[model samples]
Target: MTLRADAAGRERDRERTLAWLRGVSGELASATIKRLEETLPWYGEMPPGRRSAVGMVAQAGISSFISWFEDPRATPWVAADVFGAAPRELLRSVSLQQTLQLIRVVVEVVEDRAKDGDDVLQEAILMYSREVAFASADVYARAAEARGLWDARLEALVVDSILSGEYDDELPSRIAALGWHGHGEVAVLVGTAPRQLEVDTLRRTARHMDADVLIGVQGSRLVVVIGRATPRDDTPDGEEPVSFMTIATALEPSFGEGHLVLGNEVPGVVDASTSAKAALAGFAVARAWRGAPRPALADDLLPERAFAGDPLARTALVQRIYTPLKDSSTELLQTLWCYLDTGRSLEATARELFVHPNTVRYRLRRVADIIGWDATHARDALIVQSALIIGAMSESAATRRRPTRR
Candidate 1:
């Protein structure tokens, strides 16, 4: 009879405490919002609409706590009940840290009010606060995961558009959305893709170099479109902007074992197709050169590219080399031709031209000064020879096509 009486009194006291908590739940929510305005500066700075949304979330949290106090089985719905009260935009404008601060303020207000109540009330507040914190974290984590997947898909689409040279009006807006920091000049780098691509590491490396890249993998090939994060004019005093070739060399280790070709730098990203074409052409014919460097400039492989029937390479050789030499002076052209025909021997060249060896040597130096290719180097000799042959053939063809006077 004594044990039954004690149990009945305890149950009556619990029921009375529950009644008192329900009565003051509205007061608790009001105090929590007041405390949030005082303690959290971010809450006060929010726009009026967002501030109202936050207040709704606070009121919802207090009501959910009361429901949980009545029955512990409602623990699973505590987070949903509180957060679901706010607008969807609230999750975006309010950061996770700010949300936790709001939670802290609510718990503090509730704890201070329940101080005079039984120990069970204070323990329930603490447990409820912990659950809300975990739920907020889960909500933010899901949002971030969804955002990451969207960014990856958008990035892949941008890279595809760049490689295909298909520009729509929305391309600029899309690039801006991707947070592209590239400014003025852009270049393309082509190489073999590694067995496993470490995309994050490559991005980190590009960031360290103060550059930005758009990476794509097509079959076994990898293409990276690089741009300067900082413009040339904006570089600090006494420091020059890094050259594209130097940048390519630094990024060389990221590629698989094969030829790495760097295209000529273009004016901007919109003109990147020209550079991409050159890099792709050089990559195709890189093996034709016996001693080509691992990271070879597309311009340096003009002869090999021309042999592979790349019209751009052929035009570059003729326009950059043959035309300038032929236009400058016929003597320089003849000297270069004789020098190459005589196997690069100064004495043989001089004997064939019936001039002093010193004169032949002087003319060869002039050839290098005018056209930027030296007959003494075997590779350059081949390039100069190819240009002369193509230039002569074109001249003969033009002559044959001329109308004879009747």
Candidate 2:
């Protein structure tokens, strides 16, 4: 009976304390908001409606603490209740650091006012404040996770648009929204997707090398359009950017074991569709080249692409290599033709041209200066031979189409 009386008396004391706390709750909430406005720059900058929402949270914290003191086991409920009074948009408008500052300001006000209370009440306030801090972190962590997922979906959409070459005016804005840092030349790389692709690893690798990429996985194929994340020293005065082959070499480990193909470089990300088309076309026919390099250049596979009926490859060969030489000087063209036909032999080419071997050397060097390909190199010889065949055929077709000059 004595114990029961003690319990009943304690309950009455709690009821009296709770009434006092409720009476001063308004004053405590106003003081907390005043402290926040004076201390936190972000809080002071908040719009009036959000500030009111913040005030509601401060008031809710005071009420929740009173309840928590009455029932010590209500710690979890009290912590969440404080944030529940805040508007939904509060989480978006306010950063976690700012939210933490708000919590600190309110806790300071509560601690200052409640310090004169019994030791038990003061300890409860301290513990409750800790719980609130953790709960605030949880809220922001969840928001960050949701935002990451949304960005991933948006990135996939952007990559799909690039691959399909179907773009609208909104594409540039969407790319910007993805935080793409690339602003210079862009090249596309195509290869078989790895069995266990780690996308985060790929992105980290690119970032480490100061490059950016738009990655896409299409069935067994993996496509990446890569570019410099910042201006490169190698590209001073708008000179050609670092060779895409060097970038491809760095990224080769990201792909599977099969053949990888890198497209010709384009001016920028918006022009990447041109590079992507060439990469895709080259990748399709890469298997036909028995000795293809691991990261074969798209232009190097032009013959294979042309055999596979890729008109772009044929046009590229004729326009870039053949037309330039044919229009510059017939001597450069004839010397290149004779050098390739004579198996790159200086003496044989000179015999065919009825000139000294030294003159033939001069003409071959002139051809290299006119068209960047050196006919002496075996690979370049193959390219020159293909261009000559295509160019000759193109001229014959044009002549047949022309009205007979009478």
Best candidate per TM-score, number?
Answer: 1
Query: Where is model 1 more than 4 Å wrong at Cα?
Result: 1-21, 75-79, 393-406
Candidate 2 clash pair list? none
lDDT (Cα atoms) of all candidates against the true structure: 0.87, 0.84
The sequence of per-residue lDDT tens digits that candidate 1 reaches over residues 190-296 is: 99999989888887888888888888788899889889998888899999988888888888888999999999998777777788889999999999988999799
User: Lowest lDDT 10-mer window, candidate 2?
Assistant: 230-239
For 332-393, candidate 2 gives per-residue lDDT tens digits of 88888888888889999888889999998888888788777888887777777888898899
Per-model TM-score, in order, reads 0.87, 0.87
| Best model per lDDT | 1
Model 2 deviation from the true structure expressed as Cα RMSD, one decimal place: 3.2
